[model samples]
Target: MLGQAVALLCLLAGDAGGLAFANAEPAWREKERLLENNKTLPCAASGTCSLGHTRQWTGDIYPLQGLRDCLRARVYRREIILVSENRLVAGFQLYDNMMQMGYDHIVLMSTEENCKRALRAWPQVSCIWSSQVFAATPKYMLDRHAFLPRAARLGVNVLCLDSDSMFLSDIYSHLKAPPLRDMALMALKDPAIGWLNSAVVYVQNARPDGPSVYVLNEVIDRLERWAEAREYMLGRNRKDFCWEQMAMSDILMSAVIGRPIAYGCWNWDRNVTYRDAWEGAHKRYFGYNETGGIGSWHFLKETKVPWPKSLAEHAPGFRRTEGVTHQQVIQIPNTQGVWPEEFGGPLYAPVRGNKSRAWMELIKSDGMPLWADPEDPAQAAANAANRELFTYLPEWIGIAYGQDGTSGYWNPALYRGANGTGTSPYALAHFYRLFGAPMNKLTVKMANNMWNWELSHLLHPRGGVFFASTEHAPIPDVLVYSPEVENREWVSHEEWDKATKALTRLAMEMGRTVVYPAPRCNLTWLGGERNNHLPLEIPMQFKHQCIPYSPSGKGFNDNRCMLGGYLMQGCMAARWYFAGGMFPPEYDHLVVHIRDKAAEHPVATVAAEQLARSWDSEELAKTLMAQHGGLGAGLFHPKIAEKLGAAAVPAVPAAAQKPRVLIIPSVLQLTDKVGPREQLYRDHEREDFNVMSCPWIQNKPFV
Candidate 1:
């Protein structure tokens, strides 16, 4: 027969690792004896079954080790079947660990092909494959076909497991708990996305009526759903892993299983769920008095697969229990530094049950202070001093404040460069005044980079780049994209091509032109020809280019700062791509320069001017060396701020022909001692003349 004999061994264990369950069952014991005494047995059929080694562990800075350990522990207890060439080698390791604890009916299962390979290596074991039982067929379905038949041959009761699983607590007792008389086994119900999680599960092998044909059918149906929705598969973009989990869980939940209670079942993730458990535990364990409970946890590691050399490696004294897991945990020093501490947890009074003053001081000193006091003379002095450091713009190059980042209870006016003066929102009424219409120019800075797509898309419908007559509407005539490269991964090539082409086409429709800096060849290549390359490497440091903001709720992005800088930029960019429409143009003469003095290269000038044309600048100038004798010679000087001072300055108007220009100070925000925003005004009415700062928390974007 093509089908071969299969054996199933079950053992009880306490720790997620199989060591605790080694001698728990007779079947396990039998396996142990085979490993110890049987020298003549086929490598594939005898001894302990071992799997592949997982990657190394680093510190809590990386989570891969914890996840690997958990999975290894869970798989060790089972009579695992492996259809691989190194059956004997694999079997030996599995047997070694299982027998060490005492239980051992470990069997190494493999296919004939694998057996043949094993023969050349250490072939002493028997083998099996679906071809042994099923008639000759294609090999693609071998794994699927082999699974059920192998389980049936193993005596009707089997546990199906994914590679990523582990046992942290004694699961054997629960597994061994009297099987439901009617149902042979029970399995966990999966959770939905935008819903709760459904991970750890229990399964009963036999049902009084029959095998779980219903459950199997449900799996088949969902798999079909997945097949139909192939384009939307989670694996497609390598993003939205949660979607994959959701899809799988949705399928699992489709089954009409009996009331199956869910305990802590972990899968391949560690997010809010894990953080919450630890948070709650830390709170209670430190005397908060709340019942701290965690049914289960998935130790999904970070991208770096290496495991921590030891617990101490993740955090000092992490291995040695510190004071209160809670108190000490507060300043869970970010091993990864992926996000700031504020998002990690609530700010306690730096006090714990023990109330160590030193510890309190340490917690208090975790992150930098976020607020700035305008009244403080030191702060004012600092702001004033920093203002001189800025490279002033030309009189013709109007500075209009774009609503790249604005937040809260009032309408923030755009900075209108024409007629020097601008409207400032100092009171709540300003918000009411500017409501219902789009604000002035939505500056496509790093923070609001996403808005670029929105304008691009909206303007694409009408003349590609013209502003709408409506208030806060878009005037597509001018569009800007800067700080070149960032979050490049999330941008889909298809969407990019569509958007760029749309931008080009829209510019023509509006009877305007487009001026974009040609992307560096290398960057263009990185994204292929389809995507726009906005590299974050140049014009500013990563610190200045990326900022953290809230996501969800009454906060930015979603109120939670769970997603860090890169993702936030990607999401906003995506949203901006779809945000449709341009605002009314409040300015006529808006000059954009592409030159930065430090990087004195012609290529920069060439690229900047090109970019200026992309935005349909009314006029363009190229500064040059004296030898060239063009505007280039006098256009930009070594100390050009002095030369620009001699030119006729535009008079400040009550309301700029353009909306108030809000200088967000993105890349410019850095290279300074303190933040660049003006400290004087709060709302739009306080000062109608432009030049104001929104109530921005340090490192936070306006909602």
Candidate 2:
């Protein structure tokens, strides 16, 4: 009975200890030993290593060569070690992500009892856990205990990580031991204390002095002190002492013998800001918010974190205007923010003289250069007109163009001469019509069909072959043109050839149009023969009406900058009158010129205008149909005219019978350029009136 009782008591004690091991600190000793080994030894082969005072060989074993391939190709370590109680799910997820990142060795440490239970539950994730480890140590106790039985493991390093950490991207490439300090420490920045989070730590055993054995010891000692301090403060006796935090504060304040820990912004986000300041031509502001928005703030009291300056607060002659600069930040309202009151509506300007002074030129007054004339009165007026007209256009038109990636050539001028007209026929034909003008039929030919070098040509000085920087650069005896256009130089034949080949290759790769030597072509009122060689030479008086269409050769790169320039210039001109409609590459200029001729020859012009209108009218019809029918109209299908109201009398031909018109709702009208929606409804009276809505402008009917 005594022997049996003794045996039963021993079994019971073992079971109780097993339960404790399974509960907590099962992997503690193993983790501790590995930490110590990594801090002391080096890698013998690649994956296998030793820990603490014992050398042990621990790695994943595979029987097949193919299976080993997975281990080697993935750059995985032989094995990994981990500690947990009931965190198997977390453990496996962490293991998989890390394994893909190249760490292979997996060592799971739990209480012996839990280990048995967990292994039975999850056989795929093979792990080893022994209850031999009872507490946390500076070194891995499991590794240490296993070292004596197995001698193959030695000089191996270990990397320890907490379960909460996540890898954003592959960090192995940037991973390296930081510069070693004698007594290095990481500090976290807190409300009361500025320091680092000690959750994740890097341990390098590259010290020639046989590793820092006292490093972990010191940390453990500090941890003990921290716990003791916490317990003492929370005691029921209410001893005369500061809080646990106060103890930490005391330790930090006593900079007597311990080395200070260095902490910085690396591997973490830091809240840092600056004050607005300026020097010379430079301004500096760095104010930002937690949500990534930038702004300025004035605090009654200083914040715990350093505040940064606003990006726009500093300037050379900065003035704080209340309405303009709100909260010390310049509000640039984009798609998300509330747009300022001045954002939308018809831009109105005082009307200038109706007609050009010189009959030969369209305008007598000098105008501002393109793109840099938002403030110029004439430019502003033109732009305002363009915006107003833009509203009436059906949204589908823009959508269609966007889908088709509207095609056109961009042009640049190469040579400028005294007689040189800065425009091209193709440009005149396309650009003018887009602005609601009649198109002119005039074909443009290239000087060299071999290349499309329009941008460089436009930058070239006086219609000459010489480079801007060279001595041979053309000098106009009477005048020097604008420096921006004059600064471009003519490239040599070799350079041109190389450029052409390169451009061709690029175009082929990107599948875009290949255009070269783009001349500003304005074909309006100019005949094909008249504008054929418009940019070939610059003698302003060289108007040989019968210039050949094929100047150099046939089947060459003919799309010149003239075509592009003409289109753009036409768009600019269109801005003056018409509000809606995109510049069409196929028939815009043709329609405009035909409309112009319609005045002289009403029959032909009317026919051309009808066709032009038809094209846009078709798009308008499709847009309305989609709005009503929830589908796009077929391009080839005949348009079904729906009359919402009576058509107005034709102002041009009294006998011409007007067609029925479909009226667009006033609400939809303001959707594109809305302003003060409530005010708009309040201003316009509700009445039974018909609105003439063709796909084109108010009077212009689409075909």
| Candidate with best lDDT | 1
Candidate 1: tens digits of C-alpha lDDT, residues 334-410: 11212223222211212222312322232223232221222243443332222100011110111112111122111
Error of 1 at 230 (Å): 9.9
Q: lDDT per model, in order? A: 0.24, 0.23
lDDT of 1 at 172: 36
- True-vs-predicted CA distance for residue 377, candidate 2, Å: 86
lDDT of 2 by residue, 1-703 (tens): 1122112222322322222233333443435534443432223212233222121222322212322332233212323333232344334444443333323344443444544554444332334443322122322332222221111111122233433333222222212211112122111112122221222222232121111212222232233332334344234222222232232222222121122110110112223331111111011112222333211121111123111112113211213222111011111111122211221111111221221111102111112122212224444333322210000011111111111111111122221112322211110011111211212111221121112122112233232211111122121001111112211232332333233222222211111112222222222222222233322321222122111122222211232222222222222111101111111221212233335544331220122222222222223323333332221111111211121112211112223321111111111111212122112222331221122111211112222
Compute the lDDT of residue 677 as modeled in candidate 2. 16
C-alpha TM-scores of all predictions:
0.22, 0.22
Candidate 1 structure, TM-score to reference: 0.22
